[model samples]
Structures are given as C-alpha cells and as structure tokens.
Target chain A: MNKNSLKILEKNRDPFRSVKLTVGITISIIFIFPIIWMMFVSVKPDGFMTTNPVEWFTPPYTFSNYVDLIMNSLILRWLWNSLIVAVITTILTLVITSLAAFAISQMKFRFKNTIFIFFLLGLMIPGEATIIPLYEIVKSLNMIDSYAGLILPMIASPLGVIILKSFFDGVPREVIESAIMDGCSYLKLFYKIVLPLAKPAMAAIGIFTFIGSWNNFLWPYLSILSETLYTLPVGLPVFNSTYSQAYVQPMTANAIASIPVIVAFLIFEKQIVKGISFTGIKG
Target chain B: MNSKKKAWMQDLRALPFLLPFFIAYLIFTIFPIFKGLEMSLYEWNLVRKLEFVGLENYTEMFQDEFFWDSLWNTTLFVILTTPTMVALALVLALLANLNTKLQTFFRGSFFLPSILSVAVISFLAIFMLQPYNGLVNTVLQLVGINAEPFWMADKTLAWVTIVVVTLWWTVGFNMVLFLAGLQDIPESLYEASEIDGATRWEQFRYITLPQLIPIGRVILLLQILASYKVFAQILLITGGGPGGATRPLIQYIYEVGFTKNNLGYAATMSYALFFILLVLSIIQLRSQRSEGK
Candidate 1:
C-alpha cells in the first residue's frame, strides 16, 4: 500500500496498472472462493445451496446448521480439546526450544555443532514416517488418549529451535556478557534479557507452533478412539461425514474450525508471512 | 572469587537448557524411528506375538501388487500436482507482485487458504465439487455441459479433483516463496533494463526468469516431497474412493495398518515411503548446492 514502494517500479505509471488490478482481483477471488462459499452455504438452509448457487450472498440466512451441529455432537468438547492442545503445545515448544536455541546459538556448549545437526535431522523426517513407531511408543508409555500423548511429541519442533537460535545469534554478544557481569544467572538472562529482545521472533515461532498444533488431524485422529478426546480437525470431519444428506451443518462446522486460524493469520499476517519466508529463504 | 569453579558451572549451563528438547526428541522422534525400523522387520501386529522375520516384510513389499499400485498412484499424484502448482504459484506471485495499491489484499486473500487446516479445505472442496448438486457442476450446467461431471467419483477426474484441491489449499505457500524471490530481484535491474530500451517481455526474460529459477527449483523440490506425502485431503475428499481410484500410498498404508491390522506390512510400506523421500531430500540438497547459495 505504500506509495513509496510503488514508485520504485516503472510499470506503476503505465496504463497496464488497471490490467494488473483486474487480474489480481480475479486471482484473489479464486483463492478465497472456497472459504467464502463455505461460509455462504453455512448460513443458508438445506436445499437452497445449489438452487441459486450464483446468488451466494442473497440469503434468507439461518443459524440452523450451527444449532444442529452443536446440539447433535460433542463439538464444544472438541473445541476445548483443540484449545488445550494448541495452547499447551505452544507454551511447551516455546519454553523448550528457546532454551535449546539459546545454548546452540549463543553459548559455548560442548558438542554444539553435533547437537544442532542432530536437530536438523528432524527436518527431513516427516510425521507420517514417525507416526507408526510413535504410536507404539505412546501406547507403551500409557500416554495414549491423553493430552500428553498429543502435546509432548509436538513440543520438540526443530524449526522452532532453529528459528529462535538464529534470532538469538543475531543479538550482540556484549549484551549477554554485560548482563553476566551484572551478576545475572543463566536462567534469568534467558527470561529477562534474551527473550524480551527476541519478541518478534518469539511471536513468529509461537504463531507457527500454535497454528500447527491447532490444525493437526492425523495423529489426533489415529490415537483418539474416544469421542471425548477428539480435537476439532479430527472431530469435525467425522461429524461432517455422517451428514450425507445436507451440507449446511458440515459447512458450519468447517467454518467454525477455520475461523480461529484465519483470525490468527489476519492478526499476525506480516509476522506469519515473514516467518514462512524465513523458513524458506534463510532456513 | 571462585572464578575457576564458576566457569565450570557456567559451562554446564547449556545442559539444562538443552535437556527438555533432547529428552523429547529422544522419546518421540528418535525412539519411534528405531522402533519403526525394528518393528518393520518383525511379523507382528499389536495383538500377535512378535516373530523376528527380517527382510520377509521387505520381500513381501516387492511381491505385493497393492504396494506397487499404491506407489504408482502416489507417483501419478506427484506428477500431476508438482509442476502445475509450481507454474501456477509463479503466475500468481507475478500477478500479486504487480505494482498496485491492492497488492497486500491480493497477497493476503491468495494466502488465506494456506492458513486453513487441510481437513477444512478438503471438506469445503468436496462441497464445491459434489456432482450435479455441487456448485462447480451447477456452473458447468449453466454453461451448457449436459452430462454433469462426477468430480470425485470418476477415476481420472478424481485425480484431477484431488490435484485441483491441493493447488487451491497449498499454492499460497509456494506463491509466498516465489514472491519473496521476486521481490529480492532488485528493482534497479528492471529500471536499468528499461533505460536500455528493453521491452517488458525482454526485461522479464533477462532479469526475472533467471533470478526466479533457483527459487523455483527449491519450491519444485519441496512440492515433489509434499505432493507425494498428500493424505488428509485425499482421505477426506475421495476417501480414496470410486473403488480405490484415488488411494495414494499413504492411505493404503494407513488402511493396511489400522483397518486390516497389518502393522508390520504397513511399516514396511512406510520404510519404502521414507526411502523415496530420502532420495528427494538428496536431490533437494544437490539443487541447493547447484544454486550455490
């Protein structure tokens, strides 16, 4: 939106600017169309969706689907499960990764390179590859169907550690040394000094972890046999699947599941984009 | 001052810092990995008594036609999706990068689907692509296609539907990467080319295409691994349906393991999946090296 940024490109002054706008609008519509259509359908009553599909906005909208979804299923409990897992995962990831990152990047630790490389190994290992063994491990430890089963494994995100480590490394060494000279303990230095300065980095990592945890479905779906333990993503689909007749309630469930994530993205759009690009470009 | 003893204590500080993640990494990732490998060598589901049958599972993998079928399905998916996503991502990135006031809105809207969970997107897409009563088919009918397409039911079209859904759900991330790459191309280069009377196309060819290639390769490599790993969306959308028409390898593995209780065989399939990804990882590393970054 900055005029200054626009001034740098010669095409900004060209007559083709309108062409760009039209094309941009078209593509934007395509990208957001699914969610918009889902929301549109969510509010409409049964049999009205395909009748006048084009007139998506002109609605005698109802909250029937939402009411049906809530009344029929353990949706509120599912949402609660999602919230606890997401929040606890975020807190645990931040606490653990921040400390490890500090040591890996900031301190003169033994086998530092080896430790960092060990974490890097995780980057290549996909969740699908590990889930088979992890299932058995969790089962053996009697953590299955517990929040710990979900939260504990998710805490050791290698990317979070690397992101924070790189951020911490950029902090001047003198900043830490000066704090140490002032009789700061190592733990105090982490909480009171390094962490505060790394707020943007922390926010980025936190949002990423929270979003990842919130949206996680496969592991939760596989491990949680009981309806009481279902997270939103895992629970919503099963709820949706049984509604083979009308899509209204299903769309409502999806819309509700999607809202928090979209809201989070909207609130931290810049940081989220920066965090993603950071993972790509500088990862 | 006890500085010598203090220095030793200070050096030990890193241990406490590193403990939590290391402990977690050990249990979740490291332990599961070895367990998966070890269990793959056994002839045991969770219920049965364990029998050490090394490489029997491996041989069964080679002999099982379902394994080959699923692998082919996976390869087909990767082929169908990766290039289309890469090219589409580039085009979208270019359009969004156009010097305009609506750039931020365009970027955010385009990236919106990437924020939603795959489960949400898959169900929403199913709603969109749902046969004669679906929005897409309704539009097709309005436009004069008499025989309405069964997007998820027909075999070939099911693949197309899955690919289209994948593109919609994920192309945003790739666009963001490419956009980052595009912006990194100095405006000064374009400006200089314009001064030398280079046409817009010429400027794009000389400056834009070359600069975008490295980023494109990296994104391509990523999309290959990611596309092959597609599961949740496909699982929900088609349920690998129309009689296993849309079943990718991962779904097959999941079904074999849990539904049929063939954990050993499933783990064997998982190892095969891991090997394929490992090869892709090597190619990614090689491409990065070639990019000389």
Candidate 2:
C-alpha cells in the first residue's frame, strides 16, 4: 500500500512485461503464419517452391497465378453465387425472424408459447442430419441446382428468431403501450420502433447468418448438380480435386476465396466478435 | 366462451408476422425430421422410393461394418478435439486478455482463420503439409527432422493433420467466448484475493477457473456437437483415405446416399448420428437443470 512498495511492484512487472510481450508476439505469428504463407506462395513462381529451406518472401514473384485464376477458373462465378446467396439469406432471415420475434415478444397471441417452442425445437435438429429429407423435398419441388434451393432453405434457422426475440423482450412495456395509444399499427411499430431499438442484435445476427450461409457447404454441395451453381465452399473443393496437381493455382484460389471474408472481418471486426460471443452465451 | 373468442381474434394479428418463418421452418426443418425417419424405413434412392422395408435399414445399419467404423471415427474426432479445444482456447483467451499494447492484434490473428471458409483452411492444410515442398515439412527438415512425414497419407499423421488443422481453424471462436466470460468476471474478486496475499496461481485456480465454468460448459457441449458434425475439413484434407482411416459418418452417409444411390440406408445412418447428439443434449440439459436446483 505504501509508495515504495508500489514502485517495487512496478519494477518487478518490468521483466514479466517483456516476457509477456515476447510470448504474445510469438503466438500471434504462429496464428497468423498460415494465411500469410498462403498469400506468399500464391504469388511465388511454381518452381520457386523447390528451394530447400523455403523462404517466406523471395521474389521472382509474378501475378500469373492470380491472372490464371481469374481468366481460366470459375472462381469469380462461385464468388458471385456465394455473395448473392449469403446476402439474400441474411436479409430474409433477419426480416422474417424479427417479425416473428416482434409478435412473440410484444403481441398478445394465442399459441404464442407453442409457436415459440416449435421454433426452438429447431435448435436441436442439426441441418446435417436432415439433409437427406431436405434434398428429397427440394428435388420434389424441382428446385435443385437453382438459387431458390440455395437461398430459401437457408433462411429459416431458428437461432435468429431466438436471438431477436430476447432483444425485443427488452423493449419497455410502456414503449409499446404508448405506441399503441398513438394508434400505431403493430406492423409500423415493429418496423419503426422495435427494429431500430434492436439494431445491435440485428447486426450480430446478420453477421452470423451471412457467415453461415457463406460457409455452408453440405446443402449446396448436395443440391447443386450444375457446375455453375456452386457456392465458394462447394466449388473450391471440386476445383481443388480437379486441379490438385497444380500448386500455385489452387493456393491462389484459396487466397482469393478468403479475401472477401478477411476484408469483411477487418471492417466489421467488433460486430463479428460480438456476434460469436452472443451466439455462444445466448445459446 | 365470448372472452375466449375475443382473445383468439386478438391473437390473429400475429399470424401475418409468424406465418413466413413458420412455413419455411415447417417445410425445411420440422418436416425433414419426420421425413428422414420415414425415408429410413423404406428402400429409397436419390430419385425415388424403391420399397417399404420397415426397420430393415436400421437393422442393416446395426450390422454394417463401415457404419461402425465411421461412427467410431467420428467419436474419435470428438474425443481428440474437444478437450484440446477448451484448453487451447482458454490459454489463447488469457494471452489475448493480457494488458498488452498488441491485445487487439492477438485477438484478430487468432480469430482470423475461423472466419475463413472450410475450403480455404483445408486447402491450406494440404498445401502446408505437402511432403516434399510444403511449409510444415520444409520447416521440420530445417530443424533436422529428416523423416518428412506424408501428412495425408499415413494414418496417424492423417489424423494428426485433421485434428491440428481443425484446432487451428476453430479454437479462436471458443477463445473469444472465453474472453467474453473473462471480461464479465468482476475485477473486485481478483482485487480482494490479492489483498489476501494469494499467489497468482492460487488466484487463477480458485477465482478464474471457477468463474469460467458456465461458459466453459457451453463451449464443451458446443465443441462436442461441432466435432461430431466434422465433415468438410476431413473430407478435403484427407478425403477419408489411407484406406478410409479418417472417414467420418457423415461422409459415409454421403457416399451411401449420393455416390452409391442408397438413400434409405443413408437416412438410417443419419438417425444414428441424430440419436447420439440428442442424448448428449439431454444429458447436458439434465445436468444444467440439476445444477440450477
């Protein structure tokens, strides 16, 4: 508690501080090394890899792999497919789930508890387990290999509803009562009042939904029979298999595949981290 | 009766809002569950139902050697990944949580891989672990380990590649979860403990570990469930090869259903996986409830 002792504690921390810094820097390099290496290799000449004790960045590097990837491969199309599917799925999931959440949270509804529980039961049913029947249903509808098959089924996961509903529940009773007193329709109240109030939760769920749809492989892989219909995750594997012998192209393909997500992460870093912890704690 | 009728009329307004999600949930999620069960009872294919062979698929599944092998493989993956994931996540979280200038950098780098698609990570695994020219093998050779292991060919090494790649790809999310939990722990507890002259180890043993239990439990269950669903990474990295040593149940189901054209049998295997998950979930819920009491 004395000033001299406080100074002594500070002095003791000096050595430990450097130790901590060293460890942190080392671990961080280990974590980040793969992606950096991938990027470096993608640009390096294919023959350059033959060097013993491979260097991180010896350049005679060229843009040919990236150029070949863009010119020859269907990666751009797959990226487009991934983009539209993820964006549409995120938007639809948020809108539909928020509506349901608003009704469940703010409205006096018969079978409300039953409907809520019905959706919650979905949390138990992993999508992987249901893929067989789901495929059957989609095929029966003749929607296979189509964007509808990719986007629509992905919109209905129950997690968004559960997350949004909890957020909606936090809206004060008086707020709803006053809105109703102003003769506001329930729909307007949801759009104007509740949705705005729950923007942070919405952003979290939106990021999660986007990421899930973007990374979704199994369903899209199964349903999409056409080469052009493939999302990034599905398309990349087929590309990898077909071009497995080549080094630079496939590695460059991986780098290209990651660019969108990495950029999104850098921009929405806080929201993505919050979204992950939100799903974990809340689930 | 009149008041009840009025309440029903009042609740009708909710229908417009609830209908869209419910309809999708029904057709996509709820319906497939029962439909999968129905499919399991029949001799079906990708295109059509072959015949109703009630419980035959299930019975055959019980006897199927590949089914057992794949199931065991999946369970092995779960065992290999879960505890290591927790411990590693905890350590990364603590390191990131340190009062350092590079805290954000630590968090970002650790989490960056997790945001990537499975395709990207799997490709990196194969690329980095290439026997002759890959980063990992090259690095090992430099360190004087001359026997450069073929990462995806040898069975043990294949398993190691899958497990380590999986951990590297995923452990970040759990680390973030633990970080959130750590931040939630009241600083006063640590301050008070320090006043008691508790050593850092003692403080961590009692305060930090105990406070992390709730999030830790959540992470454990989530990790187990996730590890059971392991498919893409293993498939891409190993292709479940080395004579199918790493083939998971989901991959097996895919082969049976799509590749082999036996949907009925595949559906049966899916049910087996579902049952394991359901039981694990029930156990988790039961324990949580008992603890709550």
Best candidate, DockQ:
2
Worst 10 residues of 1 chain B by lDDT: B42-51
Give the lDDT of residue B265 in candidate 1: 80
TM-score of 1: 0.93
In angstroms, give how far residue B15 of model 1 lies from its true place: 1.3
TM-score (0 to 1) of chain B, per candidate?
Answer: 0.93, 0.96
Tens digit per residue, CA lDDT, model 2, B141-212: 888889978888899999998999999988988999999999999877876776888776787899999999
Model 1 chain A, poorest ten-residue lDDT window?
Answer: A1-10
For all candidates in order, the CA lDDT equals: 0.83, 0.86
Model 1 stretches astray by more than 4 angstroms: A1-9, A12-15, A46-50, A55-57, A281-283, B1-11, B289-293
Docking band of candidate 2 = medium
